[model samples]
Target chain A: MAASALSPIRIDDPADPRIAGFVSIKERDLTGRQGRFIAEGTVVLRMLAAAHHAGRGLAAEAILLLESRVAGVEAIVREFPAEVPVYVAAAPVFDAIAGFNMHRGVLALGRRDGVSGRDALIASLPASSLVLAACGISNHDNMGSLFRNAAAFGVDAVLMDETSCDPMYRKAIRVSVGSVLTVPFAREGSAASLIERLQHEGFAIWGLSPAGETDIGGIPPAARTALLVGTEGEGLPPAILESVRTARIRQRPGLDSLNVSMAAGIALHQVALINDRI
Target chain B: MAASALSPIRIDDPADPRIAGFVSIKERDLTGRQGRFIAEGTVVLRMLAAAHHAGRGLAAEAILLLESRVAGVEAIVREFPAEVPVYVAAAPVFDAIAGFNMHRGVLALGRRDGVSGRDALIASLPASSLVLAACGISNHDNMGSLFRNAAAFGVDAVLMDETSCDPMYRKAIRVSVGSVLTVPFAREGSAASLIERLQHEGFAIWGLSPAGETDIGGIPPAARTALLVGTEGEGLPPAILESVRTARIRQRPGLDSLNVSMAAGIALHQVALINDRI
Candidate 1:
């Protein structure tokens, strides 16, 4: 059986050709990673395995782990198909290959495949749904937090503009707690174009901003709604805010605004509650 | 003329005696800070100056700057009394002293003074007020986010248990965007004792947990309301949850809980809105 065929291979050398994809992970995170990404730690590894088993268009190509963690992760590793290789290395070799001290000591190489186009993802959602659309979300932490919040609130899908950072980035996936692996998402086109598509599908769009005209609480629940958020300092551009219904979360005067991800989480909770999704 | 007396001092050595407080900042952040904290970046530096001028019990003992940034922050440095020395160093010396590449080029030594006692802080609130109470928030980033949410929602004061991390930690202060300076807060004592004092003040306490009996939205606005939140994974202890009125933010079934800071922000916004504070 495929399950019985699983045996972790030992890696003594950091420069082994078989583990090339796992070398200098920190550097790979910055330079273009093509369609491949890294999933770190046990929690994310389990999520990757689950996604793979469910045929969610995310595949685990291979895994590299510290020798000590091999026994602990044996069950999770068994979930993957036999074709997937699991490499175990001592701390010295693992750290050398990663080019940094990897405290978690678990890593998996994943490839993005069969992801839906923006149009198809939007069209696939039910008539009544909650969506989070992000624009110019350049920071990976905020992007990850956004995905985590979306999963917690049962968001049908997350849409990002071309300027948004890739959700598949290692830090983003880790921050999302692997939500990026399970949640349906698409990133492409301009913010305005994405908004136009949602509007055509009879979705009520609410752009979050400090200067929004209507208070966020005052936004009535609708059949289908999209909570739109933007980058930290330069919020949704003037044109995008003007294109959609904008709402503000009232706050004390003179203080800097809430972190963008926190603001979005608050807004999503309210919308999800009123829409009865949670 | 204190303003004219404020002259920038140039330091050629990383081991300069005058700037002793700013040396090995990263190391100091983990070890004891002796009531002293570092404020970084232009935004936080401005806030520190404002706190000093307002006599809010936070004083800037010294200022350190990269030689290149001295010109830009001269105005802010002038806000401090002449007794507060402003030291300028080249990138190499500054980086060596900081034990890391100091990207923002601004740092200030601040001392906390006249911070309110738990009883004094609770008793000082008006008859009708909103407050945020945190229990076991050990993460610096989460601690900072809690304070930011408190300030945004106009919470009267923030109360933390002994187990919670210090809000004055350098990273905490930076993450809070200086909210830790302006907000009225007290962190000491056990979580149970702190909550008892709030109850004595006739404050309605709502402990947030996923298993909470009441939906957060269902919480009625009261004259004196305090929203209590716990750490990320092992949420509020059962004893605490059983003691207070419990509320939960309804969410999807299978996903991990929201980030502690994000969850607190959502609940705070709800309470603040119902109380007409926002």
Candidate 2:
């Protein structure tokens, strides 16, 4: 099979040992130890290739291509750096290992990077900048969307607190549309500690909570502002809420809150208003 | 088999005539035409029951319960109106018909309703109110979340344009967490026509565009505002943009835009500020 003329090694059997990387995708327990994340669809593969070329240091360990999709896969591979490997297999074998019908017939396994710490991220940003601090958001899709929003809204940095999920999770990466790679992010300490530290650095910490007495419009356009958003179910912890200046996006009377990610987007946009004036 | 103690309708074959409703789910061509949508998991089933009870005139056509979920199903059924049908099936048969593993062990088929029209909705809300007019959003999940935001922010109504996906789609229903039932929404005509009609009704149509010249905060808090949000990609059409007053959520420099749904949430929240002052 290794000596086959095709660039992708063909595996006729679903149970083949060579397809172990694809097989473990459905088995969540193995994901952590394997340290490999899958990227689906052509757009993501292109992103990986771009990231690889830039030496952002993220690269695919291997590529899985369905026989039917080999041509498109070949086009993508042509753009890949010389060191990358591509593997091909029958559709049934690919589907069996993927645990779902493969859309766009391409998947890549890339090694995950350890999250940077708060100081590293702070050092990376300019003196006066806008940052998004995500706290207690466990859902990967929401995390990804938040990152995408952060990038779209020109948030200078994203800081994840203790309770958030891994931004590098496969679902998060996909949902982020690979914006997670382009944006600078780090997992800081707990929300309270981070808020306190940010405040000490002359950053105004505005906690987004419906419980806030101050309207979001009242939040002065600051040179440095960090918008803090909490989890959906339980909002910002009381300690964290108290440690920061609290502001609420005014909502209708019966409605108490917005989805955390959506709330973050709204807040980030509002905070970015000062920058638009320039 | 239909008269058995367990109400078990034994079906040895996938082509069995009695299982037509379940079979139609897997056939893409038959799905929308069949006048039914599948609602899986207990939370969704419970939501269906709530919708049924709210006298909104929506009801589940039937409930399918697998052996393992029978007790939970029975609990839900007990609260359901007497007219709703409940069916119990062996695990394998239920799985076969649904074309997926039934983890929640329960599924409900609900009759589809044609989305309401704009005039009917305007007649329902107070003369002066806040409304969210979703112009061209296509993503079902985003549509659902927008409905949820509308409900949470206490927007008096939601008006979808012709290009928006049906809010009653299964994914939309689930993503809204059933708020679609609580939020009154209707499909309006094209964006330009809707804006014109809304303006005649004394509603201030605030077009939510990232590139708009005015800040969202600058909009007078006392006016009856209709926040218009567009699709993620193309944004609100030019005709629509020219037809109404425009305001943008202020964001930092270099950032492009917020997600449509999130922008809706923020705009809704900001609109609600007038209500708070009153």
Return the lDDT, model 2, position B47. 72
| Candidate 2 runs further than 4 Å off | A1-30, A33-116, A188-204, A220-224, A237-245, A253-256, A274-278, B1-30, B33-56, B59-116, B188-196, B199-202, B219-224, B238-247, B250-257, B274-278
Candidate 1 similarity to native, TM-score: 0.94
Global lDDT of model 2: 0.73
Q: Is the docking of candidate 2 incorrect, acceptable, medium or high quality?
A: acceptable
Clashes of each: 0, 7
Candidate achieving the largest lDDT: 1
Query: Tens-digit lDDT track for model 2 on A134-173?
Result: 7999888799889877877788889888778877777787
Please list the residue runs of candidate 1 whose C-alpha ends up more than 4 Å from where it truly belongs after superposition: A1-6, B1-6
TM-score of each model, in listed order = 0.94, 0.73
- What interface RMSD, in Å and to 1 decimal, does model 1 have? 0.9
lDDT score, residue A61, model 1?
96
